[model samples]
Target chain A: MRRVAITGAGTINPLGHSVQATQQAMRDGVCGIGELDIRDVERLSIRLGGQVKGYDPDSRFNRQQLALFDRFTQFTLVAAEEAIAQSGLDFDGGLAAESGVVLGTSGGGLNTQDENYRAVYEEGKNRVHPFIVPKLMNNAAASHVSMRFNLKGPSFTVATACASSNHAMGQAFWLIRGGAAKVIVTGGSESMLCFGGVKAWEGLRVMSKDACRPFSANRNGMVQGEGAGVFVFEDYDHAKARSANILAEVVGFSMTSDAADIVMPSQDGAARAISGALKDAGINAEQVGYINAHGTGTAANDKTECAAVSNVFGHHANEVLISSTKSMHGHLIGGTGAVELLACLMALKDGVIAPTIGYQEPDPECALDVVPNEAREASVAYVLSNAFAFGGLNAVLALKKA
Target chain B: MSENVKDRVIQIIAEQAVLEPADVSMDQSLSDLGVDSMGLVEAIFAIEESFDITVPFNANEPEKSDFDISSVASVVAAVEQFVAEKSA
Candidate 1:
């Protein structure tokens, strides 16, 4: 099997609009979550979220492009542009045919759906936008990325809820490793902070009204976040031969389903994915120095994830520094895993561990050494990013230093 | 109204546990009836919607929560009290 290398990375998450800004924010242990400013904010009991602030879509896209791009797709395109630009690859000839795009998103064109639904149902409108279907499709982001980059190979979208990005990235890594593609632009995007989106999640009663404090004893629940993170996954030889500036090596990826519950996470399933990634990467548990936890501040997720890590790594679990950047970025749902991968890349590439901010108290249930409250400088060779979604779907990616 | 609340609460829990109302025992804990964390949350939501009264149950720290969910009887009793208090 061929190796896969992450040649480029880009993001427009709540933390920052660029990879550098996001990384700097992570290193600063900044909290990007705050009072959400979106449509129907007054209707939401949970007012806080990680909405990408200061984003003006009109300034970024043309009239024609803006008509076809939803907020999620817009975020994806912006991030993909950065990733492709950083990789310094112009897909013109055979490279365009050998490259592809795979993205993950739970709600495609949610803004369009929310707007059109309000138009027809609330305002009693007679018609909706003609491009609504094209703009709101699940694969719209991937399709646009493929079209923009001239990548015609194996392009699609993955929608595994919160684990969407991990599953998508895992597939991209496999495609490169298995020689199905020489390059793949992969990640996820989400813009579900609209009134309808928040209204639906409010029904679940798992959303925090204040902030997301993962692993904290007094934590309430997760806060919804929005944005996208995209990366260029290239064949190792292909990248090296081109003298590309490889960001990090995608060593292994593993996904597992709980098959037990629609909402509750399973420790066994999560452990299997964690250990599976380690085994797939041919690395022992001790070799991993950092983990980007799927630490949704919800009580069930944090405790269940901690238990899974303890089960897999045992004593090494306490020694390894684990943090959930979700505390900083809020929970991005389907786009979360991709944004959280930034934390893993920081660990492997920059030797910095992003802190799990908002940790006020310690819980015995989560006894692992969570790098809390502040970022820590740590030299780590191997790292893991975990994303356990609703519907008992769990996806974990293992990364190594370039 | 209290008795009706009890029946409704038990029915919701039973449905979440995938058990028939006849098979559900008031004395049984939710765990004993196969109601995991997710089921318990769903049960809480159902009870809230059914009675129009919010149950102060926190899935993270259920013990610290004001609501009691140790047993079907406890859940029914809690719902009954909330319903009566709301009506009063």
Candidate 2:
């Protein structure tokens, strides 16, 4: 199998709007979560979120594109532009035909859906926006990304709840490794911090009313976040031949289904994916120096994830520097793993470990070293990013230093 | 009213566990009866809806939650107390 290299990366998350800026935020342990500024915020019980503040859609897109693109799609295009620009590779002729786009988003055009639903239900409107269907479709982000970049090969979207981005990126890696596509523009975007979005989650009651403090004893719940993280995954040989700057090497990826419960995470299922990723990467547990955990600041996820890591790495689990950037960026839901991957890259490229901010006290159940409340410098050869989603879907990615 | 609440709570929990009311042991934990986290949540929802009384349950911190879910009898007792307090 061919090795896949991440040549370029970009993001517009609550932490920052670019790769450098986001990394700086991670280094400084900046918390982007605060009072949400969505419409009808007062109506929802949960008003705090990690919103992409100071973002101006008008400055990025024209009237026509704006009309066609939803907030999530716009985020994808913006992030993808940065990634493609950094990759310094143009898709044309055979390359254009072979490349594609795959993205993950739980709430595709949720802002559009919220508006139309309000228009018909609240305002009793007889008609809605004509482009609502296209804008609100789950594949809208991936389709728009493909159209923007002239990627005419295999293009699709993944919607496995929170594990969407990991699942999408894992598929992209396999496609490249299997000689299917030389390059795949892949990542995820989500912009669900709207009235209807928060209201829906309010029903589930998993949201934190205060803050997201992953692995902390007093942690309330997960906080919703919005943004996008896109990357250019290319064949390693192709990138090397072109002298492209490789950010990290995608060594291994594995996905598993718990087949157990809808929302409850299974330790066995999570451990399988974690251990499977190491085995697929052909590396032992001792080589893994860091892990970007799916620590959602919820009781079940933190403890379950810690137990799974312990089960997989044993004594090495206590040594591995594991942290949840979700404590800083909030839970991006579908787009989370994509943004969290940035932290994994930081560990490899920058030799810096992102901290799990907002940690007040440590729980014995989650007794692993969480890199609590502050960033640290560490040179690690291998890092793993874990994403365990609702519906018992698990995706784990193993990355190596470039 | 006490007897009604007990029966309703037992029936809701039994339904969630996919067991007959007679088969459900009051001393058995929800997990022992095959009620996973989602099942427990659904049972709580059902209990709340049936009695029109809110149960103070947190999915994340089930152990810390005021509503006891250690066993069927404990859940029933907690519901009965909440119901009585509501009527009082």
Candidate 3:
């Protein structure tokens, strides 16, 4: 089987608008969550969120492109451009035909849906934008990415709720490893902090009104965030042939379904995916130095995830340095795993472990190291990124330092 | 004010719990009526739509919500207060 190498990476998440900026913020323990400045803020019971503030599409794109691109799609293109530029692999002729795009997003073009819904339902308007259907569709981001980059291979979007990005990236890695595709522009993007989006989440009643402090005893619940993270996942030979700057190696991937409750998480299911990923990577529990946990700051998620880690790693659970970047960036829902992958890269490439900030009091149930409150320097050779969605979907990826 | 608050609230809760209004007891809490988290949220939405009132509820801290949900009767009283305050 061919090996997959993450040759380049980019992001425009709540913490920062680029990979360099985002990692620097992670290393400095900067929090990206604050009072949200979305439309109808007073109407939402959950006002605080990890929003990408000061974004002006007019400055970055033309009017026609802006009309066709929803906020989520715009984010995808921005991140993809950065990643492709960093990879410096010109997709021409055979390369262009062999490349593809795979992105994950739960609420694709939700901002477009919200605007059009309000126009039709609340304002009773008969007229609507012609691009509404294409713009609001779930595949809009992935499709736009293929078109923008001239990718001609298998291209699609994955929507597995919170685990969307990891699942999508796993598929991309498999496609590359199986010699199916030479290049995959893969990651995730989400813009679901709109009024309707927040209202829909509010109906679930699991959102935090104060702050997102994952694995903390005083934690309330998960907070919504918005942004995108894209990566250039290339065949190792293709990358080496071009002498591309490799970010990391996609060593292993595993996905599982609990087939249990829809909203509730299962520790057994989560533990299996973690152990399975390590097995797929041909590594032991001790090889994993850090883990970007699926800790969502809710009572059920934090303890359940901790139990899963303990179950999978056993005695090594106490030794591994685990942290939730969601503490600083809030929960990006579908786009979360993509952004959290940056933290893994930081550990592998930059020798820095991102901290779980806003961690005030530790819970006994989640009694791991957690790397609380401050970033730490560590020479991590292997790391695991975990994403457990609401619908019992679990995706875990094991990455090795390049 | 075509229907009383207690009767209407019971109807909504009964619908959420998938029980007949006759089987729903006002003294029973939402949990006692077998209204899970999703059902509880739906029941609250139904109450809001029926009474034209916002329930100021957040599931993360249900205990801290200004509107009470300790019992079916408490929910009715809270809705009645909001309705009255709306007119005032």
Q: TM-score-based ranking, best first? A: 3, 1, 2
Interface RMSD of 2: 1.8
lDDT at A305 for candidate 2? 98
Q: What are the candidates' individual DockQ scores?
A: 0.37, 0.40, 0.52
Best by lDDT: 2
How accurate locally is residue A103 in candidate 1, as Cα lDDT from 0 to 100?
Answer: 92
The local lDDT score (0 to 100) that residue A367 gets in candidate 2 is 98
**Residues A1-402, model 2: lDDT tens digits:** 899999999999999999999999999999999999978998877889999998999999999898889999988988999999999989867898889998999988999989999999999999997899998999998988888788988889999999999999999999899998999999899999999999888766678888899999998789999999999999999999999999999999999999998888999999999999999999999999999999999888999999999999999987999999998899999899999999999999999999999999979999999999999999999999999999999999999999
In model 2, what are the clashing residue pairs, if there are any?
A: none
lDDT value, residue A306 of candidate 3: 97
Chain B TM-score (each prediction, in order): 0.94, 0.95, 0.93
Candidates sorted on DockQ, descending: 3, 2, 1
The C-alpha RMSD in Å for every predicted model, in order, reads 2.3, 2.8, 2.2
Please give the lDDT score at residue B23 for candidate 3. 97
Candidate 2: where is the Cα deviation over 4 Å?
B1-36, B46-56, B63-88
